[model samples]
Target chain A: MSKDAFRARLEGTAAAIESLLDRLLSSSPMPGEIARPPRVLDAMRYAMLGGGKRLRPHLVVETARLFGREDEGVLRAAAAVECVHGYSLVHDDLPAMDDDELRRGKPTVHRAFDVATAILAGDGLLTLAFDMLADTPTDPDPAVRIALVLALSRASGLGGMVGGQMLDLEAEGRFAADGKPIAGSEEDTLRLQAMKTGAILAASVDMGAIIGRAEDSQRNALAAYGRALGQAFQVADDLLDAEGEADLVGKATGKDAARGKATLVSLYGVDGARSRLRRLVDEARDSLTAFGPAGDALARTAVFVAERQS
Target chain B: MSKDAFRARLEGTAAAIESLLDRLLSSSPMPGEIARPPRVLDAMRYAMLGGGKRLRPHLVVETARLFGREDEGVLRAAAAVECVHGYSLVHDDLPAMDDDELRRGKPTVHRAFDVATAILAGDGLLTLAFDMLADTPTDPDPAVRIALVLALSRASGLGGMVGGQMLDLEAEGRFAADGKPIAGSEEDTLRLQAMKTGAILAASVDMGAIIGRAEDSQRNALAAYGRALGQAFQVADDLLDAEGEADLVGKATGKDAARGKATLVSLYGVDGARSRLRRLVDEARDSLTAFGPAGDALARTAVFVAERQS
Candidate 1:
């Protein structure tokens, strides 16, 4: 498929996933008119329904198709991934964390509501994601479901997203364990980027494959594809941070360099980072051979990762 | 059993459970740790290992016993509960949240680490709980595992703990959902309180029962028992806030009154609060008849919850 057609496919997938999540979110209870605070509902709605690329969930639904398993089960998994993604952004923008004031061109959750409400709202969304997965129709063997839950949790937890945040925090003049600098070496930086951004993406694709009954080797191959794609995503993100317009990016730009946040450009310089990203794109494409022509969406995703400005 | 012996039994259960968690935690990789940062490790350790009373995990293990199921799988369920509880405490102490400087008479996670580290650590622990549940070896039954994950996630999430927090936050300001004064009714106060404290405690007990293959009705009974006990637990907590010696409480005492935090004592004076607590305790004990003597640990838990000083 040509790049334009591929982009169109991704956009379509994003819409489908967003609609599913919107439905899932609208179904949550409002405490009561006499007691239900609109702020809580507002915060929850803003965090979950605030539309983005829906990259994670798209990866899920598309990858599920590879194994001929596209069902309602993918919807639950999609919501679960999106919930985690939304929460990470909310928490990341908190005053104590990244403390950004804007998200997706709108005020961040803490800025929209108060700090406590945002915190609780994010917590609510995160937990609800797991609840969605846990409640998935048990047609998939219990063993498979357990593995799915495990992958989703780990992807969101210390080994993936949280672990990435810890490294980011510790790198910013905070000491690290064993007195090693939190950020050092090109390999270390890439590894951190992969775990933080890549792991969840990998989980998204790999999980869809697993749910669709893909063989173990196929799942592992997709995981490799996701990790490569995730690296490219971060590098593209870093590039946007460097040169993209804030309006197009939909949030603050140039903040990464300003905050001295340890990113690809910081460690490897612009040219070096781009060079590495090109390599990652190729690696990602190579990993897609397992899916054969069925990975057209993902193959286009890799190219988009390397070239997208935002 | 004497109170000390009873406390010891609970403590012992927690310790064994913790021991299981230690193994599980160590076995899981720290994702961002290429060489493993010490500060991050310390932060994770601080919030997780050797911290707080392992009440949630103990309840899980004990509840499993109530259902006549005791196996390695319970250990995984217990670990999941502890991880959630730890995550809550870590976030609860953040400067933006409760601003608690001490937990369990030790420096809180944020105090020990920085605010950002504490936040990520809490996030890590919370997600890790779900991951832990995914690894249960005994019951490969996805439905059982899924039930456990769903129950735990809901308890920790909005319809449960997080929701209760928003209510508590509003209550603290004496503002209802519409920015009006909260009703000064005992029913209103208990309703919110039950969702907050009661929800997760109920989940804790129900988790054990469900894992032990308890029928839905038995699970409901355990949930009711836990809800009552959990409320009693909150009542005792409020009582501590009001009447317990500051020195004895060791953690912060009277913070509820000082912060204008909403609580049973805040709404009802000491006598009224005590009377309400007595009713909850009686209900908790009465629910135990269903378990016959099998509910002995839970029944004893209710009595201690009603009478304990701290």
Candidate 2:
């Protein structure tokens, strides 16, 4: 496809993903006026709805299309994963956690609301994802749903994103750890990045695949796509942190080094990080070969990750 | 049976709950360091292992026995419920939330560890409970397991514990408002208490019924037991806060009114609250009549909840 064609597809896909997000956010059944609550819900809605590429949902849709089914059932599950992703970001930026006061060109959830509400809102969103998935019993066998639940839980819990966080907490200000150096080889850099960002991204794909009834081989390929794409996505985030415009990025930029945070560029330098990002995108696209022609969204998303400006 | 026989069952059941709590704490499939993150894990173990009544887990086992099956499966479900209950307390005591620096005669989790770790530790336990229930699929069908997942999520999320919290937050100075005596009725007070401490207590029984194959009538009865038990439980807690010894209660005592916190006594006079407590207990025990002889543990538990000291 031409650049224009791909761009149009991305815009249409982003719109579709936004509508799904709207369903997820608007569906909360909790009645309001919580403690005169300082507009916590407003903060939560602002952080989540104001900005997101929805790449994860897009991947879910593309992978489901490989199975030749694009029903609401599949889309809802896709949306649930995206909600989790949104929740993580909101909480990650909390004063007690990452402490950023800006998100998506708006006040961060914690700043807009209180820290307590931001924390609860993040928690509400996380539990809501599991609830949404568990509510739909499309998988007839008790075993399949069990597997899907386990997959998502493992991805979200201590061994995945949360675990990565513990690692981040421990590794901050360290010279070189987890086989990755402050200036290390590509693989070493990836090992560090994988635990930090790669695990959830990979789990996001496998979760959607298992629920959408992807075959074992397809699931494996999806996993491969997830790892490659996740690293590229992280590298792009690092690049944005290094050189992106504040207004365009919609978040406070240039804090990666200021906070002494670990990133590919921090480990491997900016040029090396850029080179590795291209390599990751190439491999991520190659992993889509198993999807034949049905992997267009996954492939296009990888390219977008490598080239994203902010 | 005499009091001796009843005491034996209570001790044995409490021991069983303790064993399950320890096993879950140390034996998850996650790597040791990842599963048990030092002080955070210690705080979780301490808060859960403290010598309390083991009220919720006992309800699960007794209710499961009510249905004539109390095997590994039911105990596992029971254990899972305790995990959720224990974890909620850990997070609820965090500085960002309730800010309790002490609990159950020991330091609170956030005070024991840091606030961030306490928050994540609680999250780990919450998801771990559902993961356990969802993984063991021998009894509850996918549909039923699906229901259990939804039920637990709702109980833990804003609609239940968190919703009650919002009320607790709103009710915080509600009594002293404008110095105009006290406002709201006994009905409103009961509803508030039911949501706060009562919802999950009730959920413990409702969950047992859901997982143990109880009939609709039995389930309804158990739910009533839970609601009434939860109310009585809250009332007992309130009484302790008013009149119990600090050492006896294992935490600060008589701090509720001094703190201007929400309690039945805060809404109604002390005499009125006492009378209401009696009525709630009667109603709670009355709900168990449908269970025939299967509800002995539940009946005894309701009485204990109404009158227990610390």
Candidate 3:
């Protein structure tokens, strides 16, 4: 697959995800709900609907497609992944967390709304993700739906994304008596990054496999591909923060270094990080080799992750 | 059943839930997880264990018991409910939300830990609730597991408890330009209370019904009982807040009136609120009438809600 073809597919998937999210976050109450609480609903919409690379959802959709499963259920699962991703971002940008004011070129949810609303919105989104997965529309098989929920909760819960965020905060010396940032070892950085960013990214692909009912070997292969792709994506993000212009990156740049945040880029020089990115991309592509032509889009995606400017 | 019997049963259930939560939130990581950061795990433990009436979990266990579910799975489901309840309290006590310095005669999570740790702990707990529900141990049947997940997410998400919290904030005029607390109408207060407190309480019974595989009519009766029980619980809580001593209640009292918070107690005066509580308790007991002797404990619980001094 050519770069242009991959970009078009990515963009198309993002658009579809945006539409689905809009419908999901509508002001009307869902069944079993009393009222939508418009302010929180609006904040949730602001946090989720308008923008994102939609890379996670795209991975979900494309990986499912790779396994010869194409259906609306796939899109629903994809949207569910985006909800978890979006909720994490919203909470992460709070004053108590990263304190990021801008995300994807728009004000962070806490900045756009009050802290209380932002917190509630994040909670709502996180809960809704599981709700969506358990719904029959996501998959006809109850076992499959339960599997998706279990995978997502494990990926996003204590020892995964949330734990990763906690580790990141600790590395920033938020809990230290001295209140000074402390850099971690290279191995520690790897573990932290994997937990914080890589887990959810890997789960996105893993979910696709579950939805598509992939064989154990196929699932393992996709999981390997996803892990490498996730690391590559993070390295590329760090590289963008280190080198890309703020305008192009769509958020503040060099803040990672300013915060003395532990990153692979900080341990490895820009040149070394770039080389690692290349290798991870190669590994990601290699994992999908067993799938042959069906894996082309994913292989292209690995490249796109490594080569993304923002 | 005598009051002593009910109290002993409640304490036994609470102890069981505490043990389950301790095991679930252990420092060791679960499968697929990379690592459990000690600080966050500690925070999660601090937020969850050694607390409260465990009223929600007791409701779950007893309701299931009412339908003859006596296995360990009932306790696991009950523990999951407590996780959600714990997560909500942790978040609600944040400086940005209720700014509660204490709970159950001890420091709140945010007071004991920093705001960031508290937030992450809450997130971790919330995510784990679904993980627990979807686990095979919760139910041998995937459909039952999915049903529990769907019911929980709806009860706790946008239109339910989280939405209720948002409405409560709005009623306090948190979003108003003038920054003045505004009292809501009686109807608005009812809606808000139902969503915020009643929904989860109702869900506890609904989950019991789901786990016990209750007949549709039995489920409906239990749901009605749960809803009324939930309202009675909140009204009793408000009365405690309005009139109980801080020492006996195990936390500060009269803060709601101080903050000009809307409550049925605030809308109807103490005498009126007491009358309302009695009527709700009656309604709750009435809903459980079809269950005959199995409903006796639940009926007593309603009276307990209305009459408890603390």
Candidate 4:
């Protein structure tokens, strides 16, 4: 697949995700709900729609397509992952967390809404993610729906994304006895990054496999692909922060180093980090050997992760 | 059933929930997880265990027992409800929310840990609630597990508890156009209380029915009981906050009025609120007509809600 074809596929999936999210976050309440407060609903819609690369959902769609499964259930699952991703961003941008004022070129949820509304919006999104997965529209099979919920909760829960965020805060010396920043070893950085960022990204691909009902070997292969791709994506993001222009990145840049955030880029020089990015991208593509030409788009995505300007 | 018997049963279920939560929030990482950061794990455990009445879990246990589910799975489901309740309290006590320094006779999670840790702790507990439900131990049948997840998420998500919190904030005039507190109508208070405090309480009973595989009529009856019981519980809670001593209630009293919180008590005055509480408790028990002797414990619980000193 050419770069343009991959970009078009990615953009198509992003648009679909946006539409699904809009419908999910609509003002009307679903069955079993009392009422949807308009203000919080608006904040949730603001946090989710019209933002980000939608990379996780793109991975879900592409990987499911790899296994010859493409349907509404796939889109629902993709939207669910995006909800978790969006919720994490909202919470991470709160006054207590990263305190980011701008996200995807718009004010962060807390900046757009109040702190309390932002908190509830993030909570709503996180809870709704599981709700969407467990709904029959996500999958006809109860087992499969339960599987998706289990996978998602594990990826986003204590030992995964949330834990990763806590570790990141601790590394910033938020909990240190002397109140000074703590520097982590390279191994610690790798583990933290995998939990914080890699777990959810990998789960997005694994969820597609679950929806596709892939064979164990196929699932494992795709998971390997996802792991490498996740790592490469993070290293690429760190690189963007280190070298890319703030206007192009759509958020403040170079703040990571200033906050003493432990990143692979800080441990490795730009040249070394770039080489590692290349190696991971190769590994990502190599794991797609089972899919042959069908894996071309995913292979290109790995390249996109490595070479994208933002 | 005697008051002592009901108290013993409640304590037994609470102990069981505490034990289950301890195991679930243990430091050892579960499958598919990289590592559970110690600080976050501690914060999660701190937030969940060693506090509160465990009223939600007691509701689950009794309601499940009212049918025929009396096993480990029932305990697991109950624990999941408690986790959601715990997470809500943790978030509600945040500096940006109610900013309460203490809860249940101890410092709030945000006070014990930093705001960032408290936020992540709440996030972790909330995610784990779904995880515990989705796990096979919660129910051997995947369909039952999915039902539990769907019901719990709806109760706690956008149009439920989270949405209720948002409405509560709005009612406090947090978003008032003229920068003044908004005085909500009686209807608004009723809806807000139902969503904020009543949804999850009702879910506790409804979840028990789901676990017990109650017939549609039986489930509906239990739901009615839950709805009335939840309203009664909240009214009693407000009464306690209005009149009980801080030492006995385990937190500051009368803060609701100070914050201009929209509660039934505010709309009805002390005597009227008490009368309404009695009426709700009667309604709760009236909904249990089908169970007769089997629902004796639940009937007693309603009286407890209305009459308990703390």
Candidate 5:
């Protein structure tokens, strides 16, 4: 696929997700807006509706399409997953965490709004994500909705994203004295990255498969594809941070090295990380062999993940 | 319904919920600990165990008992609601929010641990609450589990608790110029209080009703009871903050007045708030009239909510 075609596909996904989010989180007098406070909705919109690649939602859509099931339910599930992703970004940019002032080429939620509002907005978005999954509109079968909730909570909770965050913070030497690095091997760094970003990204595909009601074999294949894609995405992200310019990356660059945080690129040189990324992308594309021509879009997605500037 | 009998029942309920929470949040490999990490589990345990009246869980169990269903499922649902409540308190006490130094006669999570850990702990607990609701052990019927997830998310999300916190922070003049009190009516104050504490408390009963598969009329009646009990509990809490000693309350007192925060008790004086509290208790007891002797435990709970010192 050409760069222009991939960009068009990404923008279409982003537009769909942004509209769905606005419908769900808007403070206007919709069916559920009877009790929604305006200021909180404003803050939530700020965190959710603006701009990003919407890569997680794209994975959800494309994976569900693999099973030949595309409906409003899939779209809502995609939006739900994006909500969780957006909330994590909001919380991660807080002053006590990464302390980032900019995200996606704009002020972070905490910088645009007050700290308290930003915190509440993140909390609201996270809770709403689960709410969306359990909502009747998410799927006709209640069991599928329940399964989505269960899988997503596991992906985002103690053993996954949040727990990984705690490890990442500790690795940043915030708990250590005199900037002494914490002890961990190369495998540990990869595991940390997998847990923090890879889990949720992979879960997006898993959720799509669950909603589409794919067979176990197909589900396993998609899971493998998602895991490999997640690895490629995160490693590419680290490489961008390690080497990309601030203008292209849309946030501070080289801060990972400055903080002495552990990353795949940090443990291996940039060339080594780049090589691993290429191999992961190849693995991701190879996992969809069963789907043949239907998997071409996903294969293109892998290429986009590997080469994107931001 | 003697005081001694009620005390014994309350203690029994607390012990049961505490044990369940320990099992759920523990790092030990007792079934669901496949991917649980240790440090985040420690923070979650600290946030959840060893504090509060366990009023919410008690509400859940007793309400379910009123419908003649008492089992592990109810207990797990009870523990799940408590996790949501506990996580809210943890996040509410963060430095950017309440900035409190102590809670339940001990240091707050941020005070006990660091701010980043506290934030992650709160995030983990919230996710786990949804996870528990969707876990098969929580209910035999997947639809019931989905219903529980749906109801709990609505209670915890933007239209409910988190949005209320945003309003409460705004009422504290956190967003006002020079800390000037915002304009509002008495009804607005009560509505704010209802959204903050009342929603979750009522949600506990709603969850119980859903789990037990109550009749429509019974569910509505129990919902009314829960709402009234919530109001009574909050008014009593405000009165305690207004009049009780700090040591007796197990945390700070008179902070509401000091911060110029609006509350039912602050809007109306002590005597007025007490009268309202009595009326809400009567309303609650009256709502349970159809259940007759089966609701005796819940009736007694209303009395306790009205009269408890802490």
Candidate 6:
């Protein structure tokens, strides 16, 4: 697929996911509830809508499409994943966490709203994500719906994204229980990155595979593709932080080095990080070989990850 | 059952739940991982273990017992509910939220740990609750597990506890979007209390009923019972806050009135609140009439709720 074609596909999927999310966020999860808390709803919408490449949703859609299933089910599942993504970003940007003030070319949720509202907004989004997955529209089969919930819970839960965040916080010298610095080996950094970001992105693909009821072999291959792409995405992100213009990157650039955050880019330097990103993108593309051209959009996504400025 | 018998049963259940929770909190949710972030794990354990009334879990057990099923399934489900309760308290006590320094006789998670770790610890516990529900040991039937997941997500999500919490925060004059005081009518206070505390406690009973596969009539009865009991519990709690000593209550008292946080007790006055509490307890006991003597302990629980000093 051409880069333009992939961009168009990605854009369309993102638009669809955004519209669905807008409606989902606007309404109360409990139908009979009197009102949606306006402040939290606004914060949730501000964080979620009109932003980013929608790369995770794109992964969910393309992976499902490769399995010959592209419909409302995948769309709903994709939207749920994006909610989790948005919630993480909101929490990550909190004054207590990464202390990021900007995200996606706008003030972060905490900056846009008060810290209390930002926290509730993150909580609301996180809770609603599971609600969306379990609601009947996500799947006809209760078993399949349950599978999605389980997979998402594992991906987002402790030992996954949340645990990774805990490690990231420790690495920042925030709350080291034993009074020791956590910034250690490159392996530690890689492991932290995998948990913090890779888990959810990989789960985005894995969730689609589960929804599509992919065979074990197909599921494993897609999961591998997702994990590789996720790592590549992180490396590319770090590279952007190291070298890209601050305005083009949306948030502050060079903040990772400023915070002494251990990253692949920091350890390997720019040229080495770029090489690693290339190898990862290749691995991602190779994992999708069994699907032939059906995997074309996903392969292009890997390429885009390596090349995008932000 | 006599008051002594009920007290014994409640004590036994709390102890069992505590032991189960201690084990659950100590182990890494993901085994073989390099290391669980020690600080977050410690905060999670600290917040969850050695604490308050296991009233929610007891409700699960008693409600499930009404259907003649008493086993690991209810225990797991009950433990999951408690985890949600514990996590909510951790987040609620954050400096950005209620700003409570003490909870259950110790420093709140945010005070014991830092704000960032407290947030992550809450996040970790919330994620772990769903993970517990989804794990195979929670239920043998995938359909049953899915039902539990859906029920829990609804109970804890946007329209439920979190939404109630958002309302509670707004009432405190924190981030009311319209910049108006949210301390409104008694009806509004009841609604807020219902969403905040009542929802999850009610969910605890409903979850047990679902796991027990209670008949529709029984399920509705138990759910109604739970809702009434939850409201009664809240009123009783407010009474404690208004009238009890700090040392006995394990936290500061009279802060509710000082903060101008509307409550049923404040709306109706102490005597009126006590009368309403009696009526709710009666309603709770009446809902269990079909089970006769089998519900004696639950009936006793209602009495206990109204009469307990703490």
DockQ of each candidate relative to the true complex: 0.50, 0.39, 0.92, 0.91, 0.65, 0.59
> In model 5, which runs have C-alpha deviations exceeding 4 angstroms?
A1-6, A29-34, B28-34
Per-residue CA lDDT of candidate 4, range A86-200, in tens? 8999999998898898887889999998898889999999999999999998889999999999989989998899999988888888778876668889999999899999999
Give per-residue lDDT, candidate 4, residue B12: 90
CAPRI quality level assigned to candidate 3 from its DockQ score: high
Q: Top DockQ: which candidate number?
A: 3
Better of 2 and 6 by lDDT: 6
> lDDT of model 2 at residue A247?
88
Candidate 2 residues A79-197, lDDT tens each?
Answer: 66776777777767866566788776677777776676677677666766776677653344455566666666776665556655555554453323462313335564455456557
Candidate 2 matches the true fold with a TM-score of 0.89
What digit string (tens of lDDT, one per residue) describes model 3 on residues A1-310?
A: 8888888999999999999999988888889999998999999999988767899999999999987887889999999999999999999999999999988898888888889999999999999999999999999999999999988999998889999999999899888889888879998888899999999999999999999999999999999999999999889988998898987888899988998888878999899999999999999999999999989999999988888788
DockQ of 6: 0.59
Stretches > 4 Å off in candidate 2: A1-17, A20-43, A137-144, A173-192, B27-47, B137-140, B173-188
Which candidate, 1 or 2, has the higher TM-score? 1
TM-score per candidate, chains pooled: 0.92, 0.89, 0.99, 0.98, 0.97, 0.96
Docking class of 4: high
Misplaced by over 4 Å in model 3 are none
Query: What would the per-residue lDDT of candidate 5 be over residues B1-310, giving only the tens digit for each residue?
Result: 7889888888999999988998887775332222566777888899898857899999999998888888889999999999999989999999999999989889999988888888889999999999998999999899999999888888888888898888888888888879866755688777787888998999999999999899999999999999999999999999999998999898899998888777777778899999999999999999999999888889999999999988
Ranking of all predicted structures according to TM-score, beginning with the best and ending with the worst: 3, 4, 5, 6, 1, 2
lDDT of 3 at B183: 69
Deviation from native of the Cα of residue B109 in model 6, angstroms: 0.7
* Model 5, span A190-260: residue lDDT tens: 77777789889889989989998989999999989999999999999999989899998999999888877
- Compose the digit string of candidate 4's lDDT tens values, residues B62-106: 999987788999999998998899899999899888889988889
Weakest lDDT window of 10 consecutive positions for candidate 1 chain B: B30-39
DockQ of 2: 0.39
